[model samples]
Target chain A: MTSSAAATIALTDVAARRGNTTIWDQGSFDIPQPSITAVIGPNGSGKSTLLHLLLGLLEPYSGTVEVFGSEPREASEQLGFVPQSYHVPGSDYLTVLEYVRLGKIGNQFFWRSPKGMDQQVADAIEAVGLAGYERRRLRHLSGGEQQRAAIAQSLMNQPKTLLMDEPFASLDVRHQQRLAELIHGLRMDHSIGSLVVVHDLNPILPYLDGVIYLLDGHAHYAPTSEAVDEDLLTHLYGCPVQVTRTAQGDIFTRVTGHAP
Target chain B: MIELPTVTVQENWLEILTADFMRQAFIGGIITAVAAGAIGYFVILRQQAFASHALAHIGFPGATAAILLGIPITLGMVTFTVVGAIAMALTGNRLNDRDIATGTILAFATGLGLLFSNIASTAAANVQNVLFGNLLATTTSQLISFAVFLFLICLTIAICYRPLLFTSISPEVARARGLHTGRLNLIFLVTLALTITMAVQVVGVLLVFALIVTPPATALLLTARSLPALFLSIGIGTFAVIGGLVLSALFNLPPTFFIVSITTLLWVIATITRPQNA
Candidate 1:
């Protein structure tokens, strides 16, 4: 099947399995370039599996998954990923400068820090608003700062697209808003589009241009306004879900019922 | 109650330094310390302390078998440890599975060492030396082997520093970035095996942690920067070896005993004085 030429990510009838269990199958979606898209789904709806597929960490059972007009693995250099957990092993001893410098590493024989690597690391840190945190240990940073440092590490490659897995999982609302602004700023200044996997979509609803919601073993994508319908969300969640707008024109979603 | 050995410093310092055996012990101990210090950082970073301990025991049979065959003990130790490392690495990245594999292999290797030692009854002392180390018995040929192994380890680490650090911390991200994480894991385990083989010569199989884990573990308590921590680990390892040698000469005790004691004391001190939130 031919994918849209302009789409940054295109999945055609993609299916994924974990062990003997089929997580999701018959999934198809397209995420355009220069857009902030949220990948939202209920727990175990294969939200992370979708990110893994795009990052070329998993194989589709019987479908084509493309990123930037090529197989996901072939376009890995053009993509950056922020994993769900920031608790990396041995990160306790890594300074911000050292950890951020890791992003410059690729599949290379010898590791010679490129000329101006320090400046580039500094720039990435500054871009994340972590300007004076170069010498701070990752374990010493607050949750929001750690998330920003992870973002800075991802940006070291100057990736055209970023894939973040649950970037707001443990953050307070204020930090979440700040992260939303950072994502928006990345898109505006660096033209780096983001496909963020999130459980609660309200925190990022203001900046999100589109969403890819996984449900009933399929993925569907739509613009934010088109996807925010109460019935659609209620059906997707298999519970009573209410999508409401605040007085300041902000979108909020609340699950009005307990687990079925 | 066991009686302690008489504390005596009869040998002149200059004369002790000039002795061939003393020189060999110092050289061998220093080389082993350097390799252990460098690799122990990663060992701790990767949380593979158990595997590291297992690798040393896995080499025990090899050393005993080499004694039975009248071959170089280091060669046999390297062969067994590297093979064991490959087997453990093949078990994939799950710590639980890897530990099970390492423990299983360790059990079998210990059984084999017992068999080899039984067959080479006349060389029981040699087997004892392998278990607890006899650094003074390190031959010139074995010293050469230690130097060569140290060079290879340093070279490989230098060439693969960034990726090694990257994979050690966040393997999923490294794999996503197109790094061959499996191959890197294989390389790291092999290097770790080599370091274990060398460390076994100084502290022997049972006390390998003295050089391989304790120093780095202590260094980690004091600092949160990679380079500084690594250097501090090396310094601690070096000090333990030299101090152990000197104390052994003064007290007429086993160098391994002093080495382990010094490292354990340092680790205790570091733990007590460890910085908060570091």
Candidate 2:
């Protein structure tokens, strides 16, 4: 694990509320650079809310949140966000290539078109393993392919810190593995610190370096090895959980009183 | 000064182009079509179709109010719709409750239009022209205003194209990327209000919605790329205007019926031959 001195995202005494309900209070955590941190929580445990706080889309009711030791809003250039529910528009007039070009809109001026924008877009798409799919409209792509295009859009910005909300949801096993490998490669090569929200932890288990378990509006920070244990998960879930290691290096967990 | 072309009178469709009023209407229609088609792409992209429809209806009261106050109808329409656009922008930012806010604003605007039209007895008698339009009666000054508004629409699109697309496609990511979405939204609303006001003269209050929505939507079926779709939308709009005007001149029918009919017909053709199940 990287030292806390290399933290890319740091939150201290941060409090946030959505409408009448409080999401998190006095939430503090530091996400180290060049690492993968899996954020796991139940339905109402403020997983999505934390991403909003980091992105400055929602203001914290109190305390401070920082990205790269600066305010999140100030450091927006270095940050990338992949929302959980991104779909191609029904009247999709945008090709995948054009959609990804919008990624650089933030960093560039309205006038003075940047040089080699096409090459940059191509490289980003290729990095996400979507090279030939550039000309296709988003509506023509499959769900997994659409997700890849979304990732390519984010990757085009070359962000130092990537925040993915439910990156593995609804993905088949092969696509999920492909995404995991791609993300792992990004972390290794670019040294990008990524915080991924996941409902099922098995797909990302092999790639995770750290874990943040959110329970009752507060985060329980732990290393991957310590956080994935049966006892810790059982207590956190407020129910019996059976965790067993399989031959294929997978730690499968079954919550008791739930179907197999 | 440029020499104006003199045409030989003939019993053909081109004969209608000889009349000065017909020429003015044609120019006004072309200008209005280009503006509506260009701006309509963003409207469909952002899913603000209902809000845009509401904005058009909001101009009705402005027209009636202008007639009652003895001011230029275009001036009142611009003032009222701009104000209505601002109100909608403020109240419609909340995702879940925007439809309600838009509905309330639309109903209120319609009510004010009826009340103001009734108060101005002379204008009330000509209210059909305000609601259904009289394209052949367009004046030079009205055409100039359309030109100015069209220029402004183009300028805004040129400056805000990238960020606007970013915001429309993904508001949260755009915000995270440090875009001033609120400011962009306001600028778009103002531009839309101005464009809608210009459109009202050619197509009237009730029928302007067709031009703003149909062309761009039809273009969506033709192309999967934005630039092509934009150009196609403008092309379709221009064609519909020209076609509708010629047909109206020939059949002695209301231009609104022809304009809306041709636009909807183009959309139908597009839908039938669409590449995907759009």
Candidate 3:
């Protein structure tokens, strides 16, 4: 089922609680399509929760969630996800080529290697610059390469909206740069929108088109080029944190004044 | 099965085949071989080799209780082990996290088995076959039951193949795709329970672990893919079963021990020398 319709993720009056503590309450947000949106928040400030709700992973206590204007499962053909966890243990024997092939399974474009799977696999690997490593086992790949393979797997079907959680969690500068480039290319070349849930927002600033500032069960929006000053940073982080733009051409996080 | 392996190795070999006891042994080995290999694939994938062994051992007490009750032991063993497997799957991601829970379940089941066994006055050697396995007693009826187990396993795996594989490998990914993960896990557990129950008579408890783990472990060295490894593991298991059964028959050795030994030896050698990628 090819859906040409606009793909938007919206949550309304969503609240979640574990035991008695309310993690999020009456939070509402609408993410735009054809754009790269960054979801940034402190550890317990409902970052992953927001992503989960959007992806329909966790049903909200009281709200409606729609992806591509349909239920998450209903529109799964238009969505793809790269989760935060590492590759599953005991499944380390899968080759990079076969591992990535899983991304294509649910869709109509799935390839069991007969018709046109090779090109798709090659393109995905080259897009991530993991060209020579398809034959390597998933366990043997470096953390960054494995991340790329994960991305390759997620993109095997060329999803309309790709959801990634901490995609650059533990990568070196080179890998982070490569991933940033690929994310940029996905937006430009494939026109595939992306929502990235991240703790450290500075590394992803370059490729982002918008920001979903979440704080204590609430979310606000800002364009990527806007000045995310100390006030905005502190409010989003739920702590006093200074945002500095350095001449080395990068942003830095620093401790600011004590809260009043 | 194969003309009784008319061999010159042992004077007892030809004579034993004539005994109803030898016929049961051969049929029993064949039954457990197919049953173990089929359920073992998921056991290997769920990384539940240890957990499955623990599940099989759980039957000891139930079997003992049945022995004391004078009821058929197979039904008693299946009922308890299936419950054990289901309980483990239902609890929090028992497949992941710490081994403390598996350790607890193992101790509890073994304790129950001991309790029942201690109460039994007859304490027939047949209980040992149920606990460890006794291919020497595999009768025609048991062989039919095993064939049914094999058919059930094939049907279950066939119907739910993709979802099962998806959950087994990348559960988070499968969940993101909105697959029914919890139900699929239950299906896998049910399949595993069938293996333990069917093989309990032929290979016993200790060797059941070896049956479920060894072929897959060795196949892991040769294939980095899931389907291929599954077929390859079953293939390796069939060979192991045949070799062990024949060797035991020819030389008058315990079939379970012989099969497990050969399988373990090969797995260890493969682990040492096979390409490290897998």
Candidate 4:
């Protein structure tokens, strides 16, 4: 575990609530820099709530939430976000290039396009393996391609850390693997860490360096290897879970069945 | 039986074009069309068609109040619509809340309009003109006012274009990017109110959708690019206005009727023939 001083994200006794209902509390964790971490929890487990706290979309009910030792809002420029779903009305007509260019929008004058904006947009798109697809309308792309386009848009901010909420949702296994590989590549090539909220962790399990799991109204953090224990996961999900290892030493977990 | 004008082109085309009323109608119609088309692009993109429709009704009371007070109807309409828009914007970004706020305000404005119209029976007779519009009757001052309103709309849109687009498309991301989304919402709604005010002059409250919604809807069906779609929307709106006016001159019919018909027809055609992917 990285010390708090070197952590990219640090939460101390953080408690989150929606209205009067507490989602989670007493959450303390330090996510090391340049690592891919999975945020796994059952439905309504407040996995998304945790991400919102980090993005400053929601305030902690108590305690403190910090990104890079500052309030999330203060360090927003260094962060990028991908929502669970992105659907813009009339965006069916928006080209990939136009959509990606939106990431560079800051508190700037409307008339001034950023200098070297075209090259920056192109570079971001290429980084997400969406080269030659810039001119295509968003509606024409497949689901996986659209997902990549979304990642490209976030990369336009040149963010040091990315917060993706359910990036793997609705994607097929092949696409999920591709996205997981992309996430890993970002850590390796750009030293960008990601905290991804996900339901199924199998596709991403092999690539994750750490895990933040929400269970029984509390968050627990551990290295991926330690977090993949069958008994711990069974307790985390309240179901029978099976952890397996491939010959290549990759680890994955599957929920075996519900408790009888 | 009402006499219908002969379909034959009896008047010289140049003579009709040179007439003062015709010139004013052309200029005023084109200006209103441009503003509507530009603002309508974002309106459609933001899925605020209901809010746009509600603002027109909300302006009715303002127009009636102006008539009773012996002020310019445009002033009253602008005053009420702008106020209504700000209220709606303050209701937060939730579509459900906005619709409820808009409907409640629309209901109150309609009641106010009725009360004002009944109090001034003579001026109440002009309410029909406000509802249906009388483009050919536009005075020089009204034309100039339309020009001014158009300028304001253009300036606001120019200044707020990028943020407005960003917020409308992906508000969460925009907020995360440090945009003042609430402020942008206020600016957008006010600009929408201004556009609706100008459009009400050409098409009136009842048929305002012709200028403000149909052209942009059709433009969206044709292209996915912002600039091209915007220009196409303006072009289509301009064509509908001018064509309706020309047709009205030929038939001695109401230009509003022709304008609505032309726009509706174009929307139908575009919808049926749109690309498979679109």
Candidate 5:
């Protein structure tokens, strides 16, 4: 048996409830070490809920979640998070530089904010392709640029693992490429393990290493290279689907009745 | 009649500065400005202004109760306000939309205020100081107390400002970063309770409203940059307060009315130049 210590996320029967209604129930997953995984499903399949559980933002009624071999809060020091509204409040009034500085503020909760935190801030902003827009107010930036500022905020602390929920929604094709490029570089440069929840699977097929196909309480796990084939995809999707693979290994999942 | 140096600040400025009442009014108004602007900024960010208003009204009953018992009223006011804040914080999911709770507590507190005032040696209408305001009557000792308390409150805000801002903007993100957002919220509310109690004593309830809302609201419009926004609001607030106090002295009217009117006018001019989006 392999040593289980290196696994990043291991959840055992995590359940979430809102008042009387249950949002997610008794779900479990083993997220691989040092890799990018997409937790994908149709709408309301608890993708975001699973991420919250991993981040320790939500508690389970009857389960344990070990993120990086510790409780979510303990593991959070090495964890970075981005949500759907990444450009949420507190960014509107702040310059791109000041917005990223907030990410470093968390480091001061246990220790004083170091004098050199500005260098870390600059490095994070540079990593997100926002070197010149450093002093721009977040409101002055386009949606894509604002998102890059948010990415800079998440990357400011140099977290070992990053959990992003829908970081690419509502962006044009150009910005999407820029974001993908940013992700690619961060992975190469820092080897930062990332789990991003995305609605459109096609745009992201180029970046994913593994996929978690969720249907109600059940889940199917597969490597992007192997399980993303024509037969395997249709079964997990509960639809007649076909995967048209280009000779260069690009994947496109088209519904059976639809013309490609 | 003695020719004091024919000076730089327009023509009528020296006469206003020479008046003793004008000086007192100016100092009092400035103190009121700093207190109100600082508290109101948090009130808007936390969306707790209505709760603050309710606490002000709720203080009336507690103050009246204390007066009837021949004791200091600030104790009852602070106690009830803290209770209300703690209750609101701990309710969890049931009271997610805060307005409903604020309204309910407001109605209850006002009714109690009315009841307590009614049973006094005087009637409900006679306690105008509690319902409206009476800033003109603030004594020197009261002013000194205000300065000390204001310094302490601002110091506390300075120490915890970032986390407070984080929690105010997005509690989920704050929680993820391992901040005790709920506890921090209670601590802030407690400080707010202390502040409202002190302000209620000087400005009265109605004037307290002007102090808490107008300066910060005007500041939010005048400046887009964060640090500059705060400084601009304080500066704008100082100008309004000083001018209002001068006018209050010359015209013999309530300082609160003058303060609000001038600040509101400033806000109007700002809105004309600074559009909705920016």
Candidate 6:
């Protein structure tokens, strides 16, 4: 692993509020280059807001955020985002290939179709395991396939950093594994930095290099091993949380009073 | 059975079309139809049909006020729709729920139109033209304006095609990729306002909504590709305009009535026979 000084994204004493409610205060974190970091938080804990701040969609009321040594807005092309619900509404005519092609639209020339864009789009689709489904309409795809297509679309920009919000929320276990594999492959092959917001950390814990926990409008950056500890999680969630290790040496979380 | 309107016996379709006004109306209507058809595709794609409708009604008072002030109705309609578009865009940006802003703008516009039409009794003579259209009374200058505006719209679409499509599909993703979605939306609303002005001169305020929605809706039902649907919409709109002009001339009825009827009929047919990916 590279040193902390080689961080691709750095936030210094950032604070953000939306409509009279403070989402985050004095939040600070560093996302290293070419690493997968899970942003774990309960609902309304500003996990998505962190992504928004990094994407320049929302500004921090105080402090600074830098991506690739520049402002978030200036480094947008180097950053790709896969939103929680990438199924764009009211577009029945949009095909998978066309949807993926939209990613390249931001950086390419607008007046004419760029040379080699078709090959690039095809490569992206293939990278996400959606090769045969290029011409299919987006609405026809399964939830998992749609998510893959969204990932392929994000990959069209060839971003160095990818930010995803609740990507595994709607997928089944099988699809979640498939998406994790794809994300792991991206991190390994391209050294693409990733920050994924997850409600349940067990699904992606195997591929995550580090974790950032948000609680009570504060950020807690921890190593992967320390992040999954029972005492740390119990303190983070304000509940008695259990971390169980299975026979295969895999870890999972269970709330003390909740049924499996 | 419905009572049939008495038809004026004309020498021939060719003979009726030879009049300078008929020729002008035909050409001008075609121009408006082409522009509306192209613009309508994005309107439906982005789900801005209701906003477009509100913009048309908002232009009503502008046309009436122009008549009372002895100015061109086109200028008045353009000015009012632009103002309404800006107001609605700003409100939509702030509220996040565009329906509330659009509804509020529509109601306020309708109220202003009612007040203006009632204030100047002399302008009431032209109110019917504003509400129902005056295609037969279209002047050469209006046709020129239509052509110029159509060129500008086509140019704008051509230049901003990719970015516009990206923003329309998923604004958040596009914004993350550095496309200014708010500015794009504002530009789209203003362009919609211009389109409303053009179609208003041909189909009037009430029926212009049909021209701006029905053809694209029908095309969307028929095709599965955006470009193909766009071309299909243009074809349908142009055909309806020409057919409506001919039938209105044959029946000696108001052209706006026939145009709206024909466009609605096209939509019904397209819906019933829509392809199920066959």
lDDT of each: 0.87, 0.82, 0.74, 0.86, 0.70, 0.83
* Residues A67-113, model 3: lDDT tens digits: 87887667666677888884777447777877777666632222244
Share of reference contacts found in each model? 0.63, 0.43, 0.41, 0.62, 0.20, 0.53
- TM-score each candidate: 0.93, 0.90, 0.90, 0.92, 0.83, 0.92
Candidate 6 accuracy as lDDT: 0.83
What is the per-residue lDDT of model 5 for residues B57-165, given as tens digits with 9 covering 90 to 100?
Answer: 7677777776566555556666676677676666533234666777777688878877777778664543676555555655565567667767877876777777776
Model 2: per-residue Cα lDDT over B188-233, one tens digit each: 9889998888778778888887788899999988887887888888
* Clash-forming residue pairs, model 1: none
Question: Which portions of model 4 show Cα errors greater than 4 Å?
Answer: A1-7, B1-16, B268-278
What is candidate 6's lDDT per residue for B38-93, written digit by digit as tens?
Answer: 88998887878888888998898898888878888898999999998887777676
By summed lDDT, the worst window of 10 consecutive residues in model 6 chain B runs over B87-96
Residue ranges of candidate 1 with Cα displaced over 4 Å:
A1-7, A17-22, B1-5, B272-277
Alpha carbon deviation, residue B75, candidate 6 (Å): 1.4
Residues A77-192, model 2: lDDT tens digits: 77778888766363255788888888876434466667887888998898888889888888778898888777778876778878899989999999999988988988887677
Error of 4 at A40 (Å): 1.6
User: What CAPRI grade goes to candidate 5?
Assistant: acceptable
> C-alpha displacement of B32 in model 6, angstroms?
1.0
Residue runs of model 2 more than 4 Å from their true location after superposition: A1-7, A17-22, A59-63, A88-91, A106-111, A258-260, B1-16, B276-278
Q: After superposition, how far is residue A87 of candidate 4 from its true place, in Å?
A: 2.3
Measured by lDDT, the strongest candidate is: 1
- Model 4: how large is the Cα RMSD against the reference? 2.7
Residue-level lDDT of model 4, residues A46-84, one tens digit each, is: 998988898888899999998987898887877888888
DockQ of 5: 0.30
**What stretches of model 3 exceed 4 Å from their correct place?**
A1-5, A18-20, A106-119, A238-240, A244-260, B1-9, B15-24, B94-99
